[model samples]
Target: MSDLSGSERRKLEKLLGMGSGYVLNFSDRTFGDFFDEYRVEIDNEQYKTGGTSKANRMRTFWTVANNHVLGRVIEGLIEYANEEQCFGDSNPSLVTNCQNIAKRLLSDQPVAELDALTAISDDYDFEIVANHVREAIDKNQPEAALDRLHTFVNKLVRITCERYNIEITVDKPLNSVFGEYVKKLREDGHLESAMTDRILRTSISVLEAFNDVRNNKSLAHDNPILNYEESLLIFNHVAASIRFIKKLEASIKTKSATALDKTKDTKNDDFIPF
Candidate 1:
């Protein structure tokens, strides 16, 4: 349903395969109508793609998009089936149990492979997010940026873990930060009740989602030069965000200072009117 390119489809399939590694067969059955989707190339995907289909132009894109979706579906089905049987035919209700099993099965990945994968993850996928961040910050269009905010938060959380080499944990208290934000806004005269509320809500929701995902897998303690570069990126982004928030706070305080000055001047003039 979502716009998926040929390469994006491939990555999703890979994720499903890893998540459902216990399944015996992931792709034997036909990918039904629900799974079949055509891949279309937008302008940006052009840079990521290789040369054009010089031979059999009609069939080239059709195969790339159509087949990619079908293959991904089959792979996802395999993962679903594997997840169903993951706990030795019993339901994996306890989080620890599932985590333990996943760790046992997957924790032994080669250092080089992990290094490569994390490097891949570090390359920011700025698809919808580029526009969202731009619009949100520019016109203060929170509604339009909600979807991108979700992605940005996840990216932030992951980068945090990557840089700090610490486990990411999302507890109830930390999760309530967004809720607390809305309450603060309502109590303060700084923001409008509606628009400010939406922005705060979207920002927090994205953060909560980030917290949920950041700890799903642990990174090895060691990283290559490229990994170090990724961590640097994480550091830079985090610092920038913190700086931006502080600047906004200072701007608000500046406005308050100006208001106080104006009020004092008006009162003095009123009292001394000749």
Candidate 2:
């Protein structure tokens, strides 16, 4: 042990403490034999007095320490096994799994937020767009993810147009869809709250900037590769927008339904159709 390098001594100490039992038995002796030739030569005459009792006390201390150390080592080994592939850059599943585990352990946020955003209207188109975005993020393809966000905005606009019975061609630009849908939402009084309107307007500006980035700098066009920061920014913006829009749309539909129910009641004359 004295002759061994510092790291090697530490490794041996760890290995020695990893076994079970309160005393060094046949198994422990067998392990020590691996370094038999390298054991430091002892000058026994210098400390012969009371050496046997000291050695016995040292052995007792080590036995207790070994039991404690082995328990911790087992725990560490299990933890490492669970996260072995998590830091591997190539394994998306491992990364996601590790994130989920850590998130579960550390967070008190609503579990619903971790779930995929639910569409307030027909979900087929929304799901398709969301899946594309999810895959792009999982694969670390930030540019593709940003492009998917742009695509999602287009889909959302189209869905809004359909909801309002507004005619729009498939070839219409994103700006046109945004302008028309927002105009209709405003005119119909569905977007009544000043704060809500501000959020929507601001989000539209973000969407426009996102569109430009996708077209001019993201992988959607001939440009530089998207870095983690840029991609994460786009992802957060896109995800926030999707969650807000879906919740808002769902609330409006609920309001509309409630209003319609009131209209059917002859006693309620002030019911307004949405």
Candidate 3:
């Protein structure tokens, strides 16, 4: 069984209960052997546990309020169950169904909460990166996820340059793209705040480090496996960067359009109509 911290276990327990919405009843006749095998001490004879003792304890933990929370819980549970071996050899059918549920949860079914990077950008690259990276995470393939995140950031830089008409090659590294973006923002009088300046500078450093991590550890070439926390760190940072860049591009376009509109109004009377 893969190591599960206390919090993950709690989250999984909550997920299992949401499946039926009604309190899932486990008979002492069928699941008893399985529960006994796992040494789960039942709290009451009147009520037996579902998958584990804690399963019953946390059964009513979540209200069936929304599918979004339910989906997240299921995804987390499936990942946890696969790792924890809670539904091992005794229940192949259950495991199969759980796996199916996880896949369904991940498939193009509109999730409760859309991933901002993919949903906001309207870019095919963003969609690909979000889907594949999530699949990697679900499968515990951190290396693959981190590699995709690296590529995601790279594509973001390319898209930003294309959208803004910035005179930089799409092939440039993130740090270089960041520098050019800042320069353009300044020249266009769009770099307005010191806070924005600090964020960009910090983001460039983060991108550089992320790039190095992908090169050294991810599928770029095999190395020591990356842990979950490290992978999550890189993923979140890259996501934030993507969201920030997209917003920046949007802001620039809005400002440019407004200026163009004003300029056209100013020149309207100067034109001679045939």
Candidate 4:
């Protein structure tokens, strides 16, 4: 169910023109069409009754919809209001208010971390895997996404290992590759904090345990899946680690570039007359 507070929902309802018997410049047909675009069935029998208003349908939807669907529907309504100028000159702050609501909604989601993972790489394979993970997250089904998340982490660590020219074989496991990568980072002096080192070291075990999760407790096999709460906890932990690693890689790249520029400047200065 959506996490939106009653106050938040009321604010959205008023701002989106759903406080009346209508929604943002939409007739019943257009309203249905809009939700259909998002693959949402707003005409569900459970949300309908004799002579029900669109406002009532939306209120019921908000109560029962998952956060991800709620976010999408809210965003769509906001966009529609903007495009149609539904608020007119009555409230100059309506657009901003709607945007703030959307931001608060997203703040509770793992979207930022997912965006970070995609930002770190643009490879098609990476995007495909990330999208699969995102779909599950959006549906509030982290347990179902565990296998894809494992694949994504394995791919990410493999890419990081490749950047440092670490040898990896097809049979190498995720934790093994990650451990080697962490070792190389420490050897090269990229690891500057004792705490960071400890965290990464601990993550090696986490990923090691994750392998059993994928094989035994995820969609990778027919075994019973992990529960939703534990699955979300694992996802958050891995996502945080990925965020830290991205920052580390960016720092390393910037330093390498700066050092290379200095070496070039030194070479130019040392060049004497032929």
Of candidates 3 and 2, the better by TM-score: 3
- True lDDT of residue 274, candidate 3: 88
Give me the candidate number with maximum lDDT.
4
Error of 1 at 194 (Å): 2.4
lDDT of 2 by residue, 50-166 (tens): 243323322332332222222332233234434543223335554344334333322322122323333435678777876776655444344556776677767766776788877
Please give the distance, in angstroms, between residue 14's alpha carbon in candidate 4 and its true position after superposition.
7.3
lDDT of 3 by residue, 1-274 (tens): 1223355444444434534432234444533443343223334443333433545533422232123233444555555556665444535655555555545444432222225446346777678777886656545345556777677667667666655576666466777786777777767777779888778778778777777888887877778647756775666666666666667778877988999999999899788898
Better of 2 and 4 by TM-score: 4
TM-score of each: 0.28, 0.54, 0.57, 0.70
lDDT of 4 by residue, 1-274 (tens): 7788877877887787775688777888898898887666788787775336788888888877767667777877887877887878656676677677776665568444755545247888888988888778776678998999998998889888898898889998899899999899999999989998999999999999999999999999999999977998998888889988999999999999999999999999999989
Per-residue lDDT of model 1, residues 110-168, tens digit only: 22111211111335574345445443333322333333444554454444334324444
What is the lDDT of every predicted structure here? 0.39, 0.52, 0.57, 0.82
Clashes of each: 0, 0, 0, 0
Candidate 2, residue 194: how far the Cα is off, in Å: 2.0
Span of 10 residues, lowest total lDDT, candidate 4: 111-120
Candidate 3 backbone clash number: 0
Compute the lDDT of residue 231 as modeled in candidate 2: 71
Off by over 4 Å in 2: 1-126, 138-141, 267-274
Candidate 1: how large is its RMSD? 21.1
